[model samples]
Target: MENVKAVKPELEFTDYTNFEAEPIHPVEGLSQRIIAQIPGSSVATRILQFEPGTNTSPNGIQIHDFWEELYIIEGSIIDLELNEEFKAGAVACRPPGMKHGPWKSPDGCKIFEVRYYSKGQ
Candidate 1:
């Protein structure tokens, strides 16, 4: 332990936890950002929705066989590799070790994603 006799410490307290920043810009076609804070990419997570004609950043997720559930709240998306299409009122699930991601839509789409093993889903 080092000596602390020369200077006295100051005490302070405050409570101010809120967002007061400008909202993100609305892209013409697509965009993405975190909707809430979680532990990590694979653990309990929430992401903002992007519209049709928008493209998401290419993300290669390693789920390690962890299952996942997705709710297409609005719009539609086509998984080029899977040769599958997801539209509004549609639900798609992926089994573990699926090697998923890098999704895109021709017209754009909106989706609500719930991740398991990451968010206790």
Candidate 2:
């Protein structure tokens, strides 16, 4: 099915304060505000937030079937597997089946993400 259609009128800037953040299950200190999504599918646009001292070890290494594009909107996070820290302004594009994450944030982080299945999927 096609992605969800935009329901709001065009705006010069979006006020994120109007959106409510919902907790990401099975993982504490992580939450998301979904801006748009295609029901019954993994296709979505969202803002992910990681609270300070949060670690995603419980989730373990992540490998998914959908493409994931992420932009660090603020703060930073460290990839446990890589021992590398990524700060704001950093961006990443992960194709399906790529392994990543199980991250930790010492100072908290905010990321804008888009996830969708590739045409071949």
Candidate 3:
């Protein structure tokens, strides 16, 4: 068998959570942006977790004028647009100006999303 060694990332990780058990957002909701460039990561990668009854993009989602992708690392999510569903390990990409938020996951969800400003940047 071929063996592979686990290596460290170019970027370190930091926890993103609300100090309170409740969620917080505009209009009074909560979300946790766990990992990000704020922690000096290479890219603007984030571990965003939504609480039950919370919407990741509460007032309508907006994608940057660039490319963005999301991989469901844990739990489940429903894409309101096509009424399609995504589960753990499912990956989705939303291109520039895609209005794709205000979604709900009753049991909560954790997603890994990253943005690259330019090709191979």
Candidate 4:
């Protein structure tokens, strides 16, 4: 894996105009802003906005092939896996292949996310 250069403070989250909100795949009422990424390394940072009444699924959870860490920056969301609600200031880390989230956001939410694969993946 190539080294990812450190992101300067001033360069991060400075331009929101360029980020177009798009629907999160296989999930409804969730939009995403791909903030920054390391080319060729599968490492990405993103902002996720969940519109009110969004839910991933009612049937089952979704699992990722990469590590995912997230923080609730504004508003709140419901963790279906935990059967509870998480508000701003909440944090979560999921290891590769961890089954999680069939999530819901009754009041809407905004979260910052960082994701990457394990070494050699």
Candidate 5:
């Protein structure tokens, strides 16, 4: 794989807050800011935001072909399948083919996430 993201100088804390978030298609109240990405691949770093009262049940259970790492930046979200609430500071790593989610956030939430494939896809 080639370097897909452009190099940049160190960014200030406030710089991250300036990225515009775009709505995730067909999912109401859910949005993301893609900070870095590998073109034509499932490799990227992003910030996912869920507004208050947001529910992702419409997406159903998710199973991906790539690894997913997530860190909750603020607020909380409930995993509908697990019936568990994960709050800020929580982290999770899901390997390829893991089934998870359809989540809901009652008070809003933000998460920093990275998605990538292993050596052999």
Candidate 6:
């Protein structure tokens, strides 16, 4: 498929407790809820919430098999790779296999993220 085919689902806040929070592997202090996805594709989208003082990269930073993009919807987080803090309205994009993160959120935060692999990857 060249593009997403399913009609977009209504965007709304689902109960936080309704979704299981899965740890972002190779990282600590962050969890995510997959909100929408398309079948038979690498595409996956989620909301990631961070716990206060959460930090990743105790061992090292992380990379992914897919392109990754994120928008900070609430609060602030520190990007260890950039050594900078990002707050609400901040956006970031990373190509597949790019080294990034080892994040830290001092006061907790929530971010919306989309991840996907290009066709024939």
Compared with the true structure, all predictions reach lDDT values of 0.51, 0.87, 0.58, 0.79, 0.87, 0.79
Q: List the pairs of residues colliding in candidate 4.
A: none
Task: Write the number of the candidate with greater TM-score, choosing between 4 and 5.
Answer: 5
My TM-score estimates for the predictions, one after another, are: 0.54, 0.87, 0.64, 0.77, 0.86, 0.73
Instruction: List model 5 lDDT by residue over 84-120, tens digit each.
Output: 9999999999999899999999999999999876676
Tens digit of lDDT per residue, candidate 3, span 56-100? Answer: 555565555555678888887666665766788988776656677
Q: Give the RMSD in angstroms, all C-alphas superposed, for model 2.
A: 3.0
- Supply the TM-score for candidate 2: 0.87
Identify the leading candidate in terms of TM-score. Answer: 2
The segments of candidate 4 whose C-alpha lies over 4 angstroms from its true place after superposition are 1-13, 38-42
Any runs in candidate 6 off by more than 4 Å, and if so which?
1-17, 25-28, 37-42
Summarize candidate 2's per-residue lDDT along 27-104 as a digit string, tens digits. Answer: 889999887777667788889999998899999999988889999999999999999999999999999888998999
**Candidate RMSDs in order:** 11.7, 3.0, 8.6, 4.0, 3.1, 4.1
Candidate 4, residue 82: Cα displacement in angstroms equals: 2.0
Query: By summed lDDT, which 10 consecutive residues of candidate 1 come out lowest?
Result: 15-24
lDDT of 4 by residue, 49-98 (tens): 99999887843687767788999999898878899899999999988778
Looking at model 6, report the run of 10 residues with the lowest lDDT sum. 1-10
Candidate 5 Cα lDDT to native: 0.87
lDDT of 6 by residue, 26-111 (tens): 56777888776666555778889898988876747877678888899999988888999999999989887788877789999999
Residue 4, model 4: Cα distance from true site in angstroms = 11
- What TM-score does candidate 5 reach? 0.86
What's the candidate order when arranged by decreasing TM-score?
2, 5, 4, 6, 3, 1
Q: State the lDDT of candidate 1 residue by residue for 7-104, as single tens digits.
A: 22232433212312222244345443333323334432233355555544444333453556777767787775666777899886876657765456
